[model samples]
Target: MSKMLTYDACVERIEQLREKMIVTAAQKGMHDPLVLQYSQELDRAHNYILFLQSLNIDNLSKT
Candidate 1:
């Protein structure tokens, strides 16, 4: 993985991904499996963004 970026940048990127996923889903229809796949991808990205924003500092001490 790459170095951690600023929270703001990660947020911006996550939002852009969300918008793209929404647009693609809307254009492709909700019933499409690909749309669902994109949604799962967005969920994963969202989770990563949340982790970036709210990670516990204490965990960093582990080696």
Candidate 2:
């Protein structure tokens, strides 16, 4: 089975997305539609991080 994503990993992904989006916007202009798409993707990643952090991980121990 695939390993579950941790909150820290999600945060790192969000940071990476932000850096890439900035560089893309710089090259393509701020009004580019791709920038908005990237922003929405980042928001979704952030929400996933929050969801992971809110879970009661202690209850997920292996049998």
Candidate 3:
């Protein structure tokens, strides 16, 4: 079985994915649907980061 990824690893992967998406979109001169989809995904990643930060805050309060 595969081990679960740490939070830092997940964030790093998301960053790499975002970078790849940006580069590909720019290279292909993509517009409309593809661009919109990537932008939405990037936004979702940002939201995930915010959620993680909130969890950190909760952890700090418990300590």
Candidate 4:
């Protein structure tokens, strides 16, 4: 089973995966449709995760 990670750690891991995907896409030529789609999806996921993290911080501040 995978170990649970903190928010910051999860963000870092996502960033690393994003970078690897970018590099792989570049090597394969960014013009590939699947590569472009995957990149966009990853960007959306990262943004959503960051937004969630921000909300958590805001909630903590209110308490």
Candidate 5:
């Protein structure tokens, strides 16, 4: 089975994407399509992080 990403990993992905998005925006302009794509990816990463946090909360409540 494939291993699931930990919360820390998701946060790390967000950080990486944030850096990349900034660099892309700087090089290609804020309105560039690639920059928009990176922003969308960042949004997905943030949402995943929230989902992970919710799972943790559920687990803690169950314990």
Candidate 6:
């Protein structure tokens, strides 16, 4: 089974992806396919964090 990531772990992953994407963009150019792939991955990570935050807000509202 897959394990869920903690908020801190998610943030760390986003940071790691951002750094890798930056390096890749610099070496391969911003339009490179690899860079684009990294960017998409980063976007998904950010979206996941946002989704988690929304869940927390929903729980707070119910409390």
Please list the C-alpha lDDT of all candidates, in the order they appear: 0.70, 0.79, 0.71, 0.72, 0.87, 0.86
Candidate 2 residue 28 C-alpha distance from true site, Å: 1.0
Q: What is the C-alpha RMSD of each candidate to the true structure, in Å?
A: 4.2, 4.5, 4.0, 4.0, 2.6, 2.1
Clash pairs, candidate 3, are none
Model 5: lDDT to the true structure = 0.87
Report the CA-based lDDT of candidate 4 relative to the real structure.
Answer: 0.72
The clash count of every prediction, one per candidate, is 0, 0, 0, 0, 0, 0
Model 1, poorest ten-residue lDDT window?
54-63
Between prediction 1 and prediction 4, the one with superior lDDT is 4
- Per-residue lDDT for 1-63 in model 2, tens only? 034567777778899989988998999998889898888889888778777765646456533
Compared with the true structure, what per-residue lDDT tens digits does model 5 show for residues 1-63? 034678888788889989999999999999999999889988988888888899889999999
Q: Alpha carbon lDDT of residue 24, candidate 4?
A: 71
lDDT of 4 by residue, 1-63 (tens): 045556676677678768867887878877877677667756766766777789899999999
Model 5: runs farther than 4 Å from truth? 1-3
Residue lDDT tens for model 1, 1-63: 155656677677668767877887789877788777767766766777678655655457553
**Where does candidate 3 stray beyond 4 Å?**
1-6, 30-32
Candidate 6 vs. true structure, TM-score: 0.89
Q: Candidate 2 has what TM-score?
A: 0.71
Quality of model 6 by C-alpha lDDT: 0.86
Candidate number with the higher TM-score (1 or 3)? 3
